[model samples]
Target chain A: MFFIKKNWLTGYITIVVKGAHPELFFQILAKHQIMSWNIIKHDKETACGRIKLADVMKVRQIRRKTRYKLSFGSRKGLPFTMKQLNQKRPLIIGFLVVIIFIFMLSNLIWRVDITGLDAEIEEKVSQQLEEYGVKTGNFQWNVTSPGNIQKQLLADIPELLWVGVKRTGSAYHLEGVEKTIVEKEEPTPPGHLVATKEGVVANLFISKGQPMVQTNDVVYPGDILVSGFLHSSDEEDTNSGTIVGAEGEVFAEVWYKSEVTVPMEQELQLMKGINEKKHYLQFKDIVLPIWNFKQPSFSEYQIESEEKDFYFLKWKLPVTYTKKTIYQTEITKQQMEAEQARKIALAQARRELSRTTPPKTKIIDEKVLHESAENGKVKLTLYYSVLENIATKQPISQGD
Target chain B: MKKNKLKESIMRSITQIFDLPSEVTLKLPRITTIGTIHAYIENHQGLIIFSSEELLLKVHQGHVRIKGKGFVLKMMIAQDILLEGEISGIYYEK
Candidate 1:
């Protein structure tokens, strides 16, 4: 009878019997090893009982041996429940579709809100976000994290002083501060314009000061090129002088010496614009290559891989989608002559010197002081003359 | 018939001496009743008749008739019958 309890999973059927002796039919069923329970007699000729669904066929076979009429009343259990569910296929499919729809909706970016920025900058940020796959209706997993987006935004948009990116549910909120340029105000105190570096004055413009040095005059650091004191030549007394702030430009020629070394042999790797893409799905530490299983036919290549994580609502899934781009590279080795190497070294030294100088400075002259080729390398020591503004404000002491 | 009776008596005596159950030794039906509401019969041969008010089952050498109100067979198997109702009486007929 323990198997009878297990029969509930297979199923059970209530049977109704109508005959002169329905109970006799059940007794005969019991004798035939077809078990039944809960036998209720409705009248003198009708009776009903429950039998395992498996015994229905045997019951039908035995029914022919007697004049009793047997009919299945109701079927119940897991098998019948499954059959009923199968009958309503559309309903179940609709339920599954609704669940899938909600899941997709939860993982999509619903809105992108940019605040605290001008319309121009906001439009630029929006365009940049679209380029990064952060626009609305896009899958959230396809976009980088908010911190990464903030870093990329700040790097790409120089006008953005500070930008804050926050992801709340399915919406992206960005707050940015624009860089404001402030104008500098001059000092009201009476000051002299002194030479900041040792140079020969190439040009001089005195806007509000008396010129103390002429063109072509060599001046040392801290030497006053323009004085704030105005002394009238007719007045022999220098004690009564008008003191004012000096405003002028003193252009002078400055000199720089730099040394550079260039190797006679150079090897460079250049991309040939030929690339292949491979895609992979990563679960934990396991990487499953999904697309482009064949390796690219390239001797020298570089691989650039980008990984995007999946998220369910606010939780990050362990699975990640990775895209790898393999670019073929060509390496070329160049053997240069000693003269060519020396020339390259001189140009490199001049370029280095100019980079370290002021923005408005001009290179007036350059000369190779020394050049030598040794140990497969060319070394050059070069001198450069640059014309630049040398006047620096120095406040005067009124007590003196 | 006389020899069968003598064998039955001998077996009954032997069961009594050994302190054994008669239902197991003599192949007799064992009927258990819970108050006046339910009756459970084991080692029964067959069901003679059954209705809402009465049930008759073939036991060892006789028929056991159960007269009750609203009699329902709670379970029916090869060797056991569980009857549920208001049991008014139980009679054995040879």
Candidate 2:
């Protein structure tokens, strides 16, 4: 289709052949290989048809022998249009210059877009690229090879698993997939297992090394529960033992003692009611707040505040809405029994024990003892027997 | 004329027995029309007459006259002519 249209644009002329036998003329034209189409006969002696501009000259030379009066009907095609355009030379030159300018401009990287990265990571990568002379408005020819840039990015940005750089027209697209890093555990050296607190050894499960203390043996902090060395049996080779890292769990009856005193009469504060005040600030995520007044107006009130930041279209806005609820309170005095004071002291000691115990420790037995109750106050002591891991890895001292 | 008819009948029989196209076996003109809008004439001799309303083309044995409204000779080469228009009637003159 383009070929035909191009030929039409190259110019074709319609010509009328007035002769006795127009069919003979058509036959002759076809024989000469002169492309002519859309032939319409007016009568027996006259017909009109279109011939390409190249063939018009050939037709002029061939018409002398046919005795046919050739008259051009209409001239059309790019040749005539170009002939008219020849009068305006500067306009054509300007058009050509504009086309060349656009072609050249498209070859330069005018924009750089880095996607699929966290804000911190994107900033670091952008700074790295900028340092490497890769930025917007850099010529595509002057840019380093994408493979080299990707390698540099992968090495410099440890969190990036894969990096890709693609140039599309005037834009450079940088994308990466984040790496999931798994931390390697450091090797634990040969060590002894020591007690971290005072306890009676209830049971011992040792996987390595020799047990220095038996079940029901009372031990204190710094006592070696298990030895890291094995005694050498050979008489001549006499080393103390083969040292290894001690590994095991030691369940023990651990005693926790605390002295807590509670007065019989005390003053307690209670919340009577609550009032809330809310404020909202709307801004872009890049903006920061310089001042925030959060002081409560009431003297004997507690203020609890919550902040909620709004996100629009997945973009975090600096806009934060804060809600503060002021809880009003009143103070009153009351009297308590000695038994009640003892119980409160016991609960306080138990809470402190639990807070100090390791997360995996299990309490098997507990006892509360009222040491004294006098002078409108009471004192109590508490004990807890727990099962826990006491295998403290202590690297063997090289000097020994 | 009688001998020519006998030869034509022999060729027609050969075409039927061999299951070959009649255009290849009998040197006949192939005329294809798409409804009343377009037509293609293959193995045509030359143009006899042409106009917007009527077209006459020489074929193997005679001439084909097509009367139509807005007749256009869309394409013309050595032995093929593509015509497009609202065709009213077609006639063959021997």
Candidate 3:
């Protein structure tokens, strides 16, 4: 198309000339309708305007038989001049080449795609995406939501600690870190009130086991909550001489301490905007992407994206296109004063001590110890050695 | 004086080309072995219902017609198929 439109105009309508004589010659040609005059200039070296055939440049023309012409005249002055640019070459050719390259390179994918998997117990992380809308030959958001699908899959299977879904063109990638759940040990057989914490009995409640402490008694950590219901000493059976133990509850004093630390810098998102572009490629599969072209952000910001195909065209292509947001954010760092830090530290200590201490454990006293402050950061240490009478009891299944 | 065989042949040829709606009854083979999106209709009929597979149904003035995934009329021969008021037990009548 370009060759057809612009090539002829360059070939016949214009020509380059030099000097007053050649200029007059081109003017004659123009008058005779043999040439349409385009460019006439004075400065022979640097180009001022379009060069016509009359413009002077070192060239040669074949006349009669042997043409030994060499002088600055025009392209006609050159010995054997193939088609060469006059002067507007850079502007015309540069625009054409740049436009062509940009258009062609745009077809290449900048992202990959993966989405659509629905399974109960099975981790169809890859297969489900391939089933609904995840494959090569799709644009961003052409298949599945890369980031959201990754997070959802990870969340659904709590055993998965991490999942990374990325798009590299049409193909969607799914990398995951499966979570490992550790099992806990079972409780000891009941009947004996074993000590869970060592304590001077601050309080006591005996339901099935012996009461080892009284109220106002202090207790150490890991004293028994209650003795084991069955005593190893009482191994013998009934009448034959067996020492049988009774079942009950025992409340003892339990003590606990905790340490807390909060960093001065915290990142949080304040605002965000969304823009999405949809692309469909390949003969079959689709690649969908929701990308964010935005400013850089702090390390603490989290991003989310999603895509769902309503119906498929040709039984394979997605009929519906989805838009998502790739997010970039700046995390605002927070600075905390000494007062807030102290309060936060104390709260942390209380929560930790409360969880480990048995129920009904009272907080006797709490002391706040302010540590050294350095570089806009202050540490608050809470020496909360609490005195509480706690009863630790866990049910254990007896052998039938 | 007219040729009856030629008339039959012409009618059959016309049926094959314009009879795309009939081909809509034939079942589409499973798309993938993994997921449940097993079938898709090649020739689309206006009315479509979905359960396990898809069925193309057509309702006209007096006669009603149903085509499977490809084009089989096994149960449409005997009874009067009432598409409006939910009538069942139909066989290939036409």
* DockQ in order: 0.60, 0.22, 0.00
Encode model 3's per-residue lDDT on A5-79: one tens digit a residue: 342344322233433233333223322333222322333321111223432221123211222222333333232
**Model 1, A13-55: lDDT tens per residue?**
9999999988999999999988888899998899999999888
The residue-level lDDT of candidate 1 at A9 comes to 94
Q: For all candidates in order, state the fraction of native interface contacts they contain.
A: 0.87, 0.40, 0.00
What is the TM-score of each predicted model, taking all chains together?
A: 0.57, 0.39, 0.34
Candidate 1: segments with Cα more than 4 A from true spot? A1-92, A120-134, A140-169, A175-181, A184-191, A206-211, A227-245, A394-400, B1-94
Score each candidate by Cα lDDT.
0.91, 0.76, 0.41
Residue A336 error, candidate 2, Å: 78
Number of the top candidate by TM-score? 1
User: Each candidate's chain B TM-score?
Assistant: 0.97, 0.89, 0.21
Q: Which prediction has the highest DockQ against the true structure?
A: 1
DockQ of 3: 0.00
Report per-candidate TM-score of chain A alone.
0.67, 0.42, 0.39
